[model samples]
Target: MTLIPRGFTLIEMVIVLVIIGVLAVFAMPDLSVAAIRGQIKESGPLLDVAKQGVVQGYGALGKFPANNIEAGIPEPTKMVGKYVTRVDVKDGAVNITWGNSVNGSIKDKVLTLRPAYVDGQPAVPITWVCAAAPVPKGMVLTGVDATDMLAKYVPLECQARAATAP
Candidate 1:
């Protein structure tokens, strides 16, 4: 057999190490961010429940619900989920507070679900919007937006600007 080595060169080994380091650096933030987003998504079902309560109240009263009680939802402190500590319905908006086994970066952060509908048209179906998302043209948004979390930790659809069917 020939005396030539079959192993990688020193320079090639160094290059591979550098590439791995670079990839790890880039992947760290995304991994952490994805973990945070997953924790936040655990509250989605609770938010939907609150939204339903709000819509029921609106349909029955011809106006938005004033609070959890008016919306027929459980008390804010009583509506708890795996990663959410409370779900509050105020002025027909569902505000979710993340906590209770959530990541430190997102604990206590709030996300709001606001209701939107065509102005003066009760027949039109109600639509939901993320915190601070612009209401569609000719739509009215009811309730106060209480989203207090950073955009990076939210789902892609819930980032700074959320889109709704117009």
Candidate 2:
């Protein structure tokens, strides 16, 4: 009695593998960016909480915290679950270091924020300005890189740097 074959042929298996490989090659970059974006989203609320803390401190004490610790934020030595690795406050600026979950293009980037001072007060409520750099006089980060996740993910308060003169 002859038994009928029930398994795929070697060529069929090879074709399936090649198809999967091609699909993976195309899907990988998007998946990576999406994963990083998810992580960044998670950090957003936490950052807001920290910012609120600073505002609250200012309201109660009549000044921004001298540092993160004073603001009740602990300085991070490493990333906490694909989010911020560090939080720092100085000279009215808040700086956050990105975690490893971010893509290499912007991983470990330091985002700087400062409460906009309108008439010597921190705006009517609070308006944060995203500094392009760490310095107080740095330009705002705005529509800088269309492909840069860091620039894309930045909050609305920030503006991309202006194009340089040729």
Candidate 3:
């Protein structure tokens, strides 16, 4: 009886492995972008929660929070495993900077939240800025305008704050 080859040859196996490696290299960039997008989406909601806390604290004390410590929310907390290094309220806005160690470098992102009135209604706009390395060249960080971005996401109570503000 004649013996027949039952599996791929050594060369065929090497070629298959090489193809997989090439495909992985091409796919890695897409995966990274997807991850960043997810992070960006998550950031908006967290800022909303924190902003609500700020408004609540302000309503109770008759002033905006002096700092994240006084904002009535946990500080230095992790959002999706990334450390939120700082949050500050300034000029009727909240600024949040967060970072995480990735591949030996600290990747950081900044978000700015502002209270504004839209369509005769109050709203909060949150802008995201990424300062991490390996970012695309000439990638502008200017966030969307406060009025445009926050019109849909702002909470009802936060919207009232703008109306009540002198």
Candidate 4:
């Protein structure tokens, strides 16, 4: 009795691999963009919370906390972990910077907020910075214009910086 081989042929395997490679090539860019967007989204609420804490601290102590580690800044004590590495009010604006300690690869993100002239008005436009890392591919970084991806999410305080020009 002759037994026939039951595995995929070499050509079939190569074709499958090529198909997968094509799919990955097509999907990688979108996946990376989505991941960046997701990271930004996840960071938003954390920033909001940190801003609220800063406002509260300002209200109580008559000033924003000296830094993230100072009392009253709400140092990510609960489920948020210690992602909030720094928080400080500088040059009439609050700056909140945070990052993951695990991988240490992603750039530390900064969110600057400036108090609006109108009470309860949204803090000026947000801005982002790559903090010791290169800007991700397909992502543009602008140190001035708010439309730039990195600059869009910067807090108002940082926006004020953009408003001023030498």
Off by over 4 Å in 1: 1-3, 160-166
Error of 2 at 112 (Å): 1.3
Pairs with backbone N, CA or C atoms under 3 Å apart (clashes), candidate 1: none
lDDT of each: 0.83, 0.58, 0.47, 0.45
Candidate 1, 6-44: lDDT as tens digits: 899999999999999999999999999998888777666
lDDT-best of 1 and 4: 1
Q: Pairing residues by index, what is the TM-score of model 3? A: 0.48
For model 4, what is the C-alpha lDDT against the true structure?
0.45
Q: Residue pairs in steric clash, candidate 2? A: 141-159, 141-160, 142-159, 142-160
Those runs of model 2 whose alpha carbons end farther than 4 Å from true positions after fitting are: 1-38, 120-123, 133-157, 160-166
Evaluated with TM-score, which candidate comes out highest?
1
lDDT of 2 by residue, 22-126 (tens): 999999877766665566657766667567766776666677677666666656453244567776666445667776556675577777666643345443565
Sliding window of 10 residues with minimal summed lDDT for model 1? 157-166
